[model samples]
Target: MTFQAGGSFDIDAWDADKPYDERDGTKLTRVSVRKTFHGDLVGTSTTELITVESSAGPVAYVGIEHVQGILHGREGTFVLQHSAGSEDGTPGTQWLRWLIVPTSGTGELAGIRGVGQITVTEDGAHTWTLEYSLD
Candidate 1:
């Protein structure tokens, strides 16, 4: 059966390295982030990201996040592959999506498969929604 989950998350830590590559007015950097999930999902996550920034500000990022916690009432862990980007560095022009890594679920989350998205509110709050199923 498929299930839906929604919640907000707090960014506990964000450590970004100085630009490792810069050319044509664009910069690339590596960032490590930690977050605590709340609401329907309860747990913490660590994410590693490669981000690209232009003179217009953040343009894109790709990341892998390992989340360990309880979803709804099941306790386990899973991985999310993130792909996000903005055409003009505007919230309204961005797309932030998550793909559950196949076979990456553990414990009660085993066999989970789904896709999700992240929304950043104007006030800078981060919220998320997931549509998934477990075998």
Candidate 2:
């Protein structure tokens, strides 16, 4: 099934982290993602690349890396550490977020234990979404 959704995110490195100005220029972002799933048990994960363009500026592409755990009963969870920096994308803008989600074991996951530095965006707002993808 093909899907389309709109969302936003908030990034706060830390109350007292390095690069103070970076902490201030910090802005919330909204994005939309679409993917196609291939049917297969013990399905393989396809790489997802995202780039966001807001009315305020240029396109900001996200460079993400994920390490997923094993699948249990056609469902599994993956822990991902995403950093928003790439010489091939936006410059002077960086971010980091962690994600945990239920695996369709095929495509994009929903009903997530969305934590770390990431949140789901909807109707131009952001919120944490979690449902525990594993036991």
What lDDT score belongs to each candidate, Candidate 1 first? 0.98, 0.34
Model 2 compared with the native: what TM-score? 0.24
Superposed model 2: Cα runs more than 4 Å off: 1-45, 52-59, 62-93, 101-112, 117-135
lDDT of 2 by residue, 1-135 (tens): 222222233332212213212333343343333222222213223334444434444334344334332223334435443434333333334343545433422323334343344333334233322223422
**lDDT, model 2:** 0.34
Most lDDT-accurate candidate = 1
Candidate 1 is scored at a TM of: 0.99
lDDT of 1 at 48: 99
**Candidate 1 lDDT, 1-135, residue by residue in tens:** 999999999999999999999999999999999999998899999999999999999999999999999998999999999999999999999999999999999999999999999999999999999999999
Backbone clashes under 3 angstroms, per model: 0, 3
